[model samples]
Target: MRFTFKCYATKHPEQTVIFTLLLSIFLLAYQLRIYEVPYFRMIGLKDFEQFESAVWLVVITMGTVGFGDIVPVTIFGRMITMVASLWGAFIFTLVLISFGSRFNLSTKQKQAMHQLVSQHKAARLIISAYRLYKLKRSKEGMGSNKSVLSESDKGISSLMRRLKEMAKDFKDERPKRRRVKNSKSQLI
Candidate 1:
């Protein structure tokens, strides 16, 4: 489901725009539901201005700004406004996510990035291997203490564990052989 939505948002920008517009329409309807003539009249707006007020309310409330230019007089209208504010926040989030999802690297760019990451992992593996070698030499120099593991031994253990995990993702960069010898010594 996440993959599908990512594809939808990144591939079809037009559809995202249409989806936002639909949400706005729904928000407008919700706003107009409770804000009748009396509600608008309290804000000194003429009854015909209800539609415009609803539009403004949707815009401001969706932005989470709460401009206070328009206030609902009736309790029902206020409650509806609060509910619409919450819905506005939700709709705003979806719209932002749809837009943000559009930013993505191209196929070639992603390949380059993966290659860089692989190289970094390989370099870290080499460093860990060198550190482990040094720690072993130090332990051997300390007269092979078999009684209790020293701090250097613990450090080597932790380093070995991390190296094991890092090695998992390191792909063999060497090319595969076209033919291989079987146990009988004949290429099969």
Candidate 2:
């Protein structure tokens, strides 16, 4: 899918920005911890040497990988992990819902689909109706069997009769309308 700023802004302006901001905040907090928290640990950080290493840990945690390379060592760090996990879940759900809404068909598109399906159904109904008509005519031609149609044949005849009535009802004959003119009000 191609990315457009307009689409992003129109779809969900606040959600996208807020989610990113929160994730950045988490990354920053973990990186800038003044002292060692027992539960949170960055494996390769000898003395908070690199910010990127902390970012890497945050990303993996947010992604729910939890590779065991870096872990939360203290109670405070554990609380951070819990918050991150909850945030990740919320963000994931939001992303899924957004994806569904974005890819869904527009009203006009859905209506067009409905029309196409209706047309196809009508075509099939017409074909069946025509087949029934042909069967009736062929039976009429068989004079010897005219008086003794099978149960199935009788059912088909009944169906054809109903279809004929339906066709008559659907016929495009409009009732005449009487137009009333306001003769009292003349445009002078």
Predictions in order: lDDT: 0.67, 0.58
- State the lDDT of candidate 2 residue by residue for 44-112, as single tens digits: 445334455556656666667778776656566667666666767666666677666767765556555
| Model 2 spans with C-alpha error above 4 angstroms | 1-22, 25-57, 63-70, 141-188
Query: What C-alpha lDDT does candidate 2 achieve relative to the native structure?
Result: 0.58
Give me the displacement of residue 101 in model 2, in angstroms: 1.8
What's model 1's TM-score?
Answer: 0.51
Clash number for each model: 0, 8
State residue 78's C-alpha deviation in candidate 1, in Å. 9.9
lDDT, model 2, position 133: 77
What TM-score against the true fold does each predicted structure earn? 0.51, 0.53
lDDT of 1 by residue, 22-96 (tens): 667566646564556655557676742646666776567666798887656667666767776787777767767
